[model samples]
Target: MGLFSRRRDPESPAEPFQFTVDKVFVVPVRGVVCTGTVTSGTVRVGQAAKITLEDQSRSVTVSRIEAQGKKRSSAAAGEQAGLFLGGLTMADIPTIPGNDGSIKDGDALSGASVVSVF
Candidate 1:
């Protein structure tokens, strides 16, 4: 099946958590923060998740979740929030390709989706 064509089992016990990255920012002391709207299911602080970018994907543990400038234990679909991710840096994000073939541009989280949670 295609990426967007994938669907969840309605009878499943829990809905799969899905989030699309709208923006990524670096905090002075919080490391990398990803801001977006939860598209499906629910996400909790300390939850293990996967971030997929083009042909690459990485495992990430959610350090914290924030909504409306307040700390929250969890967030559900339709909630706009910022998630502090563990072990991710600005360098990990794809950027303009360098002379050494190390840079990759058009690396955005626009259509990225978090379809599941561990």
Candidate 2:
């Protein structure tokens, strides 16, 4: 399948990883912290992923995963957690398409999509 294709292999039972960002916080010690729900599949620390915002997509790594103040090895669909994104910074936050640098909320209007690259 193509990179952006949603088609799946019937023989494979794995669900594609997809996370919808609810809010974004840039921690001083940590990297970009994205709080959201796991839409599908599972994601683990050290896994590569693509953070999609509108027409833009950036490569990043899952540095850490936590839920309810407890660190987790992986998070599955329907679960809510905070994801520490590696290789990204405050400057990487998605801004309004044509506005003067206003950040977009993680809502359906223009939310961010974090999908596993592999």
Candidate 3:
């Protein structure tokens, strides 16, 4: 092995899952759904995560996942998916501190990143 090519430790913790939001949807009774592409690691149904937008954050659970209009149990890096954020409604999503409106339109959530919580 070369000096710069150290072997990965099998016992090491997995990388934290991350997904970048491309859009946001607020379903009347099913909770908020964020559609985007997974940038790293993997996320599964029931997984806990934190959504960070600017300086605001929210803890949520991955209640469900879908891709290509089909239901999915998990999503991995490079895949696009819609993640249902369980327990959150439109009222729970935060807006910029001084902004005048809540994140109602999908465009407001663009570029937000969701990271898995240990």
Candidate 4:
């Protein structure tokens, strides 16, 4: 037997992997809908929401806008799971009128459609 060899530790810590969402949130729904507060009245149809590793961005349509109820669920960062966003091209991030220079996560948390996964 080689005495120079030593036993290796069988236990190893799991990876410190943290997932960051892209600048768009998409969900597979039967129909198209939009919901959110007009934090920026300057928003229009065909816009993109920029999400980064620091925060989340969501894509949305202007015309699909609707009022959200409290019964609906909210959107949060890294919350899109068990869904497939296929073949859906996200529009450009629309400009909000009174933007405070902060990225919007598309209030899925407030039942907003800002977090569209395409």
Compared with the true structure, the alpha-carbon lDDT of candidate 2 equals 0.79
Give the winner by TM-score.
3
> For every model shown, what is its TM-score relative to the native structure?
0.72, 0.72, 0.75, 0.24
- Poorest stretch of ten by lDDT in candidate 4: 13-22
Highest lDDT, which number?
A: 3
RMSD, each candidate, Å? Answer: 12.3, 11.5, 9.9, 17.4
Error of 2 at 106 (Å): 8.1
Q: Output the TM-score of candidate 4.
A: 0.24
lDDT of the candidates, in the order given: 0.76, 0.79, 0.84, 0.31
As for lDDT, the candidate ahead, 1 or 4, is 1
> Which ranking of candidates, highest lDDT first?
3, 2, 1, 4
lDDT of candidate 2 at residue 58, scale 0 to 100 = 83
How well does candidate 2 match the true structure, expressed as C-alpha RMSD?
11.5
Across 36-110, the per-residue lDDT of candidate 2 in tens digits comes to 999999888888998875577889899999998999978899999999999767776645565665754434322
RMSD of 4: 17.4
RMSD of 3: 9.9
Model 1 regions more than 4 Å off: 1-15, 96-107
Estimate, for each residue in 1-118, the C-alpha lDDT of model 4 and write its tens digit.
Answer: 4889888766342212112222334434623233333332222223233222225543333233222332221232333321122223333333234568544344323332333223
